[model samples]
Target chain A: EDKVVQSPLSLVVHEGDTVTLNCSYEVTNFRSLLWYKQEKKAPTFLFMLTSSGIEKKSGRLSSILDKKELFSILNITATQTGDSAVYLCAVNLSSNTGKLIFGQGTTLQVKP
Target chain B: SAVISQKPSRDICQRGTSLTIQCQVDSQVTMMFWYRQQPGQSLTLIATANQGSEATYESGFVIDKFPISRPNLTFSTLTVSNMSPEDSSIYLCSVGQGTYEQYFGPGTRLTVT
Candidate 1:
């Protein structure tokens, strides 16, 4: 069965702290790993990592995938209250359906 | 990325009533998907709406309970029939526009009492 798992289901940190959210998956054939951020509304796309070891960054957020380990990590630096949201990870299988297998997501609470 | 919109951002419905959510994409897409997210839970794919074929539903979801219609490439609707408190959740519509990424709508928050 294809499944995705995220670690540290929930976390809390003060402003300016750094956090790493982890996601691991097991699928038939891997195509890409993606990250999303969800607040009160729908989820917004964050990062899409197709290659291993290469880090993708946007502002204070960065993510990297490790294909050998079948896992990915999302790192947030200088976290702020505005950064409080559930971080989700999903895998795009190579089978061409565009169907995504998503992780449970990690809730991050950044306090000032 | 395609821009998607959903109608009735939030609604309060009585038990046994039915509600239909509409999803519209700015650009034409071949495959659109509907998902449900309960409070504090991950998203669960309800069905994949194909333009010319019946929607393919996932486990624990059925066409009778959640009927989907994809009349065209850019428009789709999902109707939650026989609503219950258990059905209270956020329903999101997403489109895969020939890419690995999907663009999501604002989602409709349904509260059944």
Candidate 2:
């Protein structure tokens, strides 16, 4: 069975804190891993990591993938209250396939 | 970038009543997908909708219970039949962009009582 597991299901941190979220997947034909942020509505795209050891960054958020280890990590630097949301990690098993195995998201709460 | 939209942003319905959610894409897409997110759970793929063909459902999801239609490249609909409290979820529509990225619609939140 293909599965994606995320560690630290929920976290609360004061503003300016740095947090690391982990995602590990056990699936066949791993194509890429995607990260998303969900607030009150649907998730918004963050970063997609396909190459191991290479980091994808945008603003205060960044992510890296390890194909050999079958895991990935998302790091948020100097978190703000606006950054409080559920961070989702999804694994795509095939190319151009819309089917993605998603991990139970990490609930991040940034306190001011 | 492909833009997707879903009708009825949020709805409250009674159990056993059915509701059909509509999805529209701004551009022509070969692949469209439907996903369900239960309260406090991750998204689950319900089915895959392709233009000019029947939707392919994922494991544990049946066509009769959750019927889907893709009449054209940019439009699709998903109907949840015989709704129950367990059926209440956030239904999302997604479309493929190029070979790697997929864009999501603003999901329809369904609450059954």
Candidate 3:
């Protein structure tokens, strides 16, 4: 079975601090790793990483994948109170099945 | 990008009752997926609803318990039958264009008592 593990299940940081969330996976036929931000309801797409050493970024958030190590990291710099939410990491297997195996999300709280 | 809408934002049901959640996408998508998120947990895929085909369920999920119907490319429904307290969860629907990522709908929060 494909499995994903995320570290530091919960974190609290002051405003403007930087935080890093980690995700490691053991998936057969790996394809891509994805990051999402969930506030209350729906989760919004943040980044998708396909190759090693390649970084994908949007605003204050950036992510990178290490295919050789089967791991990924999401970094949030200059965090604001609005950045408080659960950050989810998921992996898509290469089977074209449209299935995603997700890790238990990291809950982040940014306090001003 | 597709905008998906789900009906009955939340409901509190008694045990043994059933709830049918509806999902509609603003734009046509080739694939729709259903997932469950228990409190303080990660999301688990329930099934993949394909247009004009039977929904493909994941391991530990059965079609009889969570019946799904996808008549076209933009719409689908998931019905949780014979609900128990364990069935209480947040159900979310998602749509994709066969790409690497998917857009999600506002989830339906169900609480079975």
Cα lDDT for residue B100, candidate 2:
67
The residue-level lDDT of candidate 2 at B24 comes to: 98
Tens-digit per-residue lDDT, B9-63, candidate 1:
9999999999999999988986799999998789888989989889989889999
Winner on DockQ between 1 and 2 is 2
Q: How well does chain A score by TM in each candidate?
A: 0.97, 0.97, 0.97
- Which residue pairs clash in candidate 1? none
Minimum summed lDDT over a 10-residue window in model 3 chain A is located at: A92-101
> How good is model 1 by TM-score?
0.96
Q: Ten-residue segment with the worst summed lDDT in candidate 3 chain B? A: B95-104
lDDT of 3 at B7: 96
Q: Residue by residue across B1-113, what tens digits does model 2's lDDT show?
A: 78888998999999999999999988898789999999989999999997788889999999999999999999999999999999989999988756666778999999999
Tell me, per candidate, how large a share of the native contacts it keeps. Answer: 0.56, 0.68, 0.71
Per-model TM values vs. the true structure: 0.96, 0.97, 0.97
Q: Cα lDDT for residue B94, model 1?
A: 88
- Model 1 residue A83 lDDT score: 98
RMSD of 3: 0.9
